[model samples]
Target: MYYQCVKLRQIIIAVYLSISLDGVADSSGPYLASGIKIGEVDQTSAIVWVRLTHEKRAHFDKLPILTKGLKRNEKDAESMPEGVARGMAGEVRVGYVATNEKRAFAWTDWTQVLAENDFTHQFKLADLKSGASYSCIVQVREVGSDKLSSTTNGSFKTAPKKTQPVPIRFIVTTCQSVRSIDSGAQGHVAYKTMLELDPHFFVHTGDILYYDKAPLCKNIKQARAKWNLIFAYEHNMNFHRQVSSYFMKDDHDTLKNDCWPGQTYGDLTFDQGLKIFREQVPMGKKTYRTIRWGKHVQIWLTEHRDFRTSNRVEDGPEKTILGMEQKAWLMRTMKQSDATHKFLIVPGPIVGPDKRGKNDNHSNKGFSNEGQQLRNFLAKQKNTYVICGDRHWQYCSKDPQTGVLEMGCGPVNDQHMFGGAPKADKTYHRFFGKKGGFLAVTVVDGKAKAEWMSADVKGNTGKPEIRYTELLGSR
Candidate 1:
């Protein structure tokens, strides 16, 4: 039976052997290696990204911008993933909105990367000025010395100008890998349901991208070909969502398995790994950022991988998951937030007391002191929400020290049973079977209430299960 299945899959993918364009079956158009996507929406700007077909030496008039070490005689295989965007090599432009003032640093125009390196780019709205909605788009140029280009655009509604407290809303989802959705996890269904609820925006908990488990393909090119197939699944699932979505990456999608900062490239794998990842994912830099919705909410995006010292096999100063600066940034953000509601988003479940602090079933207790410290700090804030993802399950809780509510989303694309709940507060409750669903958040009169809706296990795609609801903060 297994062999039969394998044979069937091969037959199903025979045509994939042919390089495709934009992940379609058409023979025309340039082949694409992967596709990055837009991340969270802010009142000011949003993020955008893409991937290329080849990665090594693109013949844009035969000029290579990143051919730092490759010999001229090397074949296309010698180039990295980003270098593979065009024919043998290529690059990409990550488009984003940034004003000369407020939070962004550059002007609005075409940004390009040379084929010699990786065709990857990231722009921050560090100076994205506060005002009306800002529209953003990225034009992907084929790095031929001639500059061939294609464009994809998206828009984000910036925060409204308000001096005093105001009501706010946003939805949260997680574990949304193409793998899970393909398996009929219904997470996307949950997301659509949440969107129907019409909140202010969307927040992705974590594991936005999954990498550890390779898709059903062999070789770098085939694997990347499968990864690029997500655009199709998204389109078929009608995954075209317009709400603002905040995103953070997990091990599979971001750096790599248990990846930490200062970790040197392991082998040629990482060389191609990083290049492909950069070209394919527009997660933005792994850093800390803050956004305020009126005077009632201040949300913080935490960076967990980039600058961390190391991981916890036992424990060491190198045991930083968020690094000293990010920790400090988190602390400061919490201390300074005057919003009635303050949200802290982590790449991993920040509230669970997992002993290993690894997956969802693990208790949040056995975790690091880092999260505990944040919990202790937020203990003072009556209105706080600590949300997390990567567990591949759904959970909800409230801090005993701080009546603040925290919710866990995902394995959205996967499946996992309920483990248990932390006993921090009467508000700390646990619910299950939401593995393939999303959270709908609503705010009215300065009060925020959240609902956890579980999607019907694919067989019942027409309907979903509303597991439960919880209120996190009230102004």
Candidate 2:
């Protein structure tokens, strides 16, 4: 009797182990790479992006089996299980409609099959009405199946017509260190606060993710994996899902610190990094483009990496930062735009003096001539603002020469590297804080107001204590 009982116990343990292993496999199975994200909303169109995983499996019982009496390749007989069709990709459907209420959505009929294994898909919905709120939905159906495997919903408000005066608000942020996740920190309070504010959209100046620091990613695969890991965080996913994002890449996220084109870092080429960036971040075909938020704001998203001369090059009249073509495009765009607020977005501060000296790449000091050229051009414009990130600290300053307001948005979750030592110079340096937070800008009737909030090391954000209000002339 004792021997029989021990044998039965061993069988039960084996069965339990088998069930546990199966559960683990199921938990780690393929899933949506990231939740749906709304990117780049304009007066008439918006872009939606998502990634889905493809899997292949065969089940004979699930498919129709051939009869034993049937011969191979018989004309009148049904195909065998071996010849049964199975889906190898997923079908993505995106729908949107005008909505006055958030929950009461009316979906349109827009669907497409994801035939390629690219792992990323982008859909552009055009012909949308201006100054209207839209409710959008994204659904993924596995190939050969009629049921949707995953679904997510989001909403965006299109820019008003050119002559319309609409109140506009947006959050500007940068620099989320991957180390924050590794340290097992609590909820991202800064992100939570931004979500609570619920601005029209959010502009990510740059340094969206770090690859050169701890837990670094060396290759394309590793970089993609890092994106997945970061987005998997509950707060991060929730923020992207609910808010429209305009993303730009900086030194660390593109390749390494102070990186430019033509610099290769161990299996990570500029093109490869750019490809991954475009795939992951939903932006226009060109890295640099202009976004018009009605007649209130005209934002120029510049590309600092591509077409830039190496930072090591000597600063002179010929040393170009914006490159010839981009500079011309920017000038043309700025000169033609009649918006109340013209925001020039860069990855780093263009007017401040860096701690390292006057020639560091972080600030525009290194490219003095090009920087001066930009300043001269801005001097002619009206209410032109330069918004930047990468300083890991917040500052509200103005270019002494051109009087253009320069606002440096602090880091989102990383440590403030600058110790707030270099005092304010001749330039307009109003406030500087070494805290992790973001900038909230509100534009109404051609006037703009900016508030800088502080986020503690623990990620808890305080109210907007530092404020900069300016009267940007009439539209």
Candidate 3:
């Protein structure tokens, strides 16, 4: 949606001019990866990221140094050369590690760390002057000549330094299929509409990349088709050459749906599967980490399937989800937060189905078992809320015991609908039945007014298929 006010018009114009020149994916130039992405701008830092076009970075590294001696375009020197080539690499090379050294935020101090376990690359920049609007880009190296070819470039504004609620946005997505996007009805149009929202942040609840090794979605070919859904978008000629994007990987994003340590989809061993993920997405290495927006909101994002021992917990105390290290990290972070609101990016279920009975869901790591532990532990702490996705509809209800609100959002584009969802006009908030949708949340004056917005009708554009919003007052 590229929403910007008159005041931001200059920034937009400037960013586009730089990008148009550097991002030329279709015509043999350096290029940026595409599809759903995320960027974080803070008062002192800004993080920009994107997936790569291949498994390695060969000649890309050489392109940059070769062009170093050449006089850069003076008007937009930082963006000139690089912006002109994004997503234009006709062939794959060494592990995609190319990054632009000039442009808006060229000197803003960026890090390009590969998520060795997956196809994601995370660029975390720190010490950015607070409140300053800056630009950024990626460049490829022309081996041995010191010549550099520029690709991706765009502008972003950092959050304020004040200890108050600040604007933070990024796009979030998961569960994309390759075949559907290319040949299906909506196709790339989905992203076209989402970008209009211009959210402050994006949080994809896993499935960022899927190969469908589990046959969970039905068939092997279908699984391959699913991978095409999201990966194909990021690889699209138009998107890579033009649009900017960020990506994160999940089970499906890595292999098959609801996949984990218990199974392997195809030829990918856990390590090999991680490499595939590392090759395609742009994500920080830390699977579980904290993103703080001012001193008001704290987001604890984690990957549940990555470091678990099968899905079953055997009370051996040795079994873990985040692993001992990540678990301790989460616990420590939770106890240390002083934000007005704490958001846990729980990718799976929280109030899961019971497991003790005959119809019990087995395993220690099962949603009902692990999820319950997490929920109860948080309840013991000061104050926090739970919001998750995976199910295709939206459900909002409060924990009868602690009076905390639990919200569910999902299936932005789905093949099914909810059946007999508990209907609650007001308090018992529930929206849609077998549909595709997303979530919209706004935190104002310490109170967050959020909703499950979906597109009940296929023809709907830019707006949700359906929407239901509720307030979760600040703790």
Candidate 4:
């Protein structure tokens, strides 16, 4: 029954569009409102995500937010009628040129964007040079016509091969809510701060958006509207346009709070949320995978919501959050990798002392069995660390049982910071703060470094103040 439901939803999404095919040709504007996303970047290849919109930017006008009892095309009954960037049918092609070289642009074949895939396309750019910066040019045209409607520009850097022992810096963050945006008029200031750092790459651990929060997204239309509204913000669009990023989804962004498989939030089913996430982002077939930045850094990104037993289930050897296959793969890859530093990127904390009421993540007692198993495995590894999201506060801790290190990046803005957990958990906490910021990690020759800094809501008028810093000697 579940599989059948999934198949039906997939078909519906494939044909869903805001405008007709004829409208695209006659329409004056088919813009790149959501900007572009570069993901799954490796030494010689990367995936570039593009979406064509009906307007130059998102509709941000005020409207009566119909949180419940949603109706399509109902001006007063729709929650975000003015916030959605209506998708249009068009043809998109991307071209690239290395930043350091004065060479002709390498262009890819034109691909059609339709409602079936939200008028978005991910173009795979292969045969790229590692450790090189590249400028991207995206051109869009009406279907069956050579006349270009729009051309957008962006840039990214590819990772160096394992043999290239180059120093690299990257940022990791999580738990961003549209409602809690530091600058409602602009976007989250964290993007600006992180952008200024000029890191080689970035990773959003999860909770990219809140589907259950106000202006509640109860249906597919509203959910997609929420996504459009977020990326429409000036800061988000500009940063993503320039930086290569890896996006992951957790409870709130995936379905709801503490969400698991086979769950539904109002009219939005679990499967619908999953489909929308993949469509909105540039993702591969699987969520859990690893990427090596250079000889010094190798990062593992995990999937938390896909294959997990219910939180209500009793704790034992069978209770799992990463499932069997992903867990085995993670262990195998970590053991085989010869990188000087290995970082495990997860949606939730593994060496945490979370609030007593929570029960979903490894930090809680509900999944202690697997949590302990992972901690034990990580104990023997050298220069390996766990980087997690979901917790609203920034923290750095070491497991008392295994001496494994873990760092939480905290929420996107200062307003979203929570004080639910104890300020001091001496047993595990090395540093803890009820503030909003991001974690910057640098992997290089003689040392592995980490810094946690805070950004203000007032457009980051002040510079990011580093609160804590850790420097580990050579491996």
lDDT of each: 0.49, 0.66, 0.46, 0.81
lDDT of 1 at 445: 71
Answer with 3 or 4, whichever has the higher lDDT. Answer: 4
> Model 1 over residues 1-475: C-alpha lDDT tens digits?
3235323433422322232114232222233333335554455555554444443212222213122212223332222232223432333443343322255424444455544433334554544555344444444444443344343444444565445455566666765443344333222445544534434556765555444432322235533543444432333122322345565655555435666544432232434544554454445554467777776667787766556544544443345567677778777767866676777776676555432335311123323455566666767766777777666566786555545456775555333323322333333455544354666666667777777766433345544456677766552
Estimated TM-score per prediction?
0.66, 0.79, 0.68, 0.89
Q: Against the hidden true structure, what lDDT does model 1 obtain?
A: 0.49
**Error at 92, model 4, angstroms:** 1.1
- Which predicted model would earn the best lDDT? 4
How much is the lDDT of residue 268 in candidate 1?
A: 21
Number of the top-ranking candidate, with TM-score as the measure: 4
Error in Å for residue 350 of model 4: 0.2
- Lowest lDDT 10-residue stretch of candidate 3: 71-80
Q: In candidate 2, residue 404 scores what lDDT?
A: 66
Question: Is 1 or 2 the stronger prediction by TM-score?
Answer: 2
> What are the per-residue Cα lDDT tens digits for candidate 2 across 120-179?
677888888888766666666655455565555666668788788888888888777544
Arrange candidates by lDDT, descending.
4, 2, 1, 3
lDDT of 4 at 334: 97
Greater lDDT among 1 and 3 belongs to 1
